[model samples]
Target: MKLSNEVKFNYPREDIWKALHDPEILKHAIPGCEGLTLQEDGSYDVSMSLGVAAVKGKYNGKVYMTDIEKPNKYLLEAEGSGSPGHVSMKMDCNLEETEEGCLLKWDCDAEIGGKIAGVGSRALGGIAKFMAKKFFDDIKKQLKKGAYTN
Candidate 1:
């Protein structure tokens, strides 16, 4: 599946970029995130329990940030598996400075297999979108709470 979106933040682009990489901020923002730990290689080990729609599962995954352009863009590659099934995804994120703050544009390509796929693509698409939006919105909230102060 392919998904994309744009989000505007009232904060500076730099702060938004940094906040995206901050483990604490992500854990606080990501819905159902139980843990987010940074690895020595710079990837993040993430654990999440999602209870939304037909995609409910406890997932353990590694998210790698690559092709990074500081304060501008990056790519996220992640793979995870649980009782529901397995998922692998690659997402590209871009940020543009706006007069108000920053404009974040992101797109993702995902492959899902197992029981989750049996739920049908339409339903899964909606669930994916819901989770993604909640994540971005929560990031904004975390930023507002001064989670990304330098």
Candidate 2:
């Protein structure tokens, strides 16, 4: 699957970048995130629980950031497994100053196998898009509030 989105945040690019790298902020912004731990070498370990139309489960995953260009751009790659399936994705994220604050653009490609794929591709795409939108919206709200707690 392929996903793309653009989000406008109420915070400066630097602040948004900081929040993006912060495990605390990520745990809050990500849907169903139970825990996120930062590791050495700019990697992260994450756990989340999610239930789509027909696929429901908890996923434990590892993510790493690479090709970073300071506060401007980076590449993120992540993969996770649940009881019945697993998903792996790679995304490129770019940030820039906008009239409102910061503009973030991301393009992602994902591969899924096992039971989750049994739910059907179209349904999964819809669910993933909804979840991604919600995540970005939450981030925008958090930025507006200066910080998000718990």
Candidate 3:
């Protein structure tokens, strides 16, 4: 599946970039995230429990950031599996400085298999969009509360 969206933050791109790489900030922004550990290779090992429609499971995943251009853009690669299924995604994120703060735009391609894929593309697409929105919403809240500031 393909997904794309944009979110505006009331902070500078540098601050937003720092927050994006912070495991503590991500653990709170990501839905159902239980733990997030940064690895030596700059990848993150993540564990979370998620429920989407009739599918519910615990997922363990690795997230890697590449092609990073600090405070501007990067690529994210992730893969995970659970009892319900497996999923992998690659996304490109761009940060644009705005008058108010910054704009984060993302485009992603994802693949799924097993019981989760059986849930139908329409349902999966909706769930993906919802989850993306929720993630950004959580980030917005954290930023507003100064949870990610240095």
Output the number of the TM-score-best candidate: 3
Better candidate by lDDT, 2 or 3:
3
TM-score of 1: 0.94
- Per-residue error at 7 for model 2, in Å? 0.8
Order of quality (TM-score): 3, 1, 2
Model 1 lDDT tens row, 54-130: 55789899999999999899999999888888889999999999999999999999999988898888988998899
List candidate 3 segments past 4 Å from native: 148-150
For every candidate in turn, the CA RMSD to the true structure comes to 1.4, 2.4, 1.2
lDDT of 2 by residue, 25-111 (tens): 788999999999998777999999988676789999999999999899999999999986999999999999987678999999999
Q: Which ten residues in a row have the lowest lDDT in candidate 1?
A: 48-57
- Report the lDDT of model 1 for residue 80: 87
TM-score of 2: 0.94
Any residue pairs clashing in model 1, and if so which? none
Over 1-150, each residue of candidate 3 has an lDDT whose tens digit, in order, gives: 999999998888888898888898899989999999999999999999998788899999999999999989999999999999999999999999999999999999999998989999999999999999999888888888886565
**TM-score for all models, in order of appearance:** 0.94, 0.94, 0.96
Q: Against the unseen true structure, what C-alpha lDDT does each candidate score?
A: 0.89, 0.89, 0.92
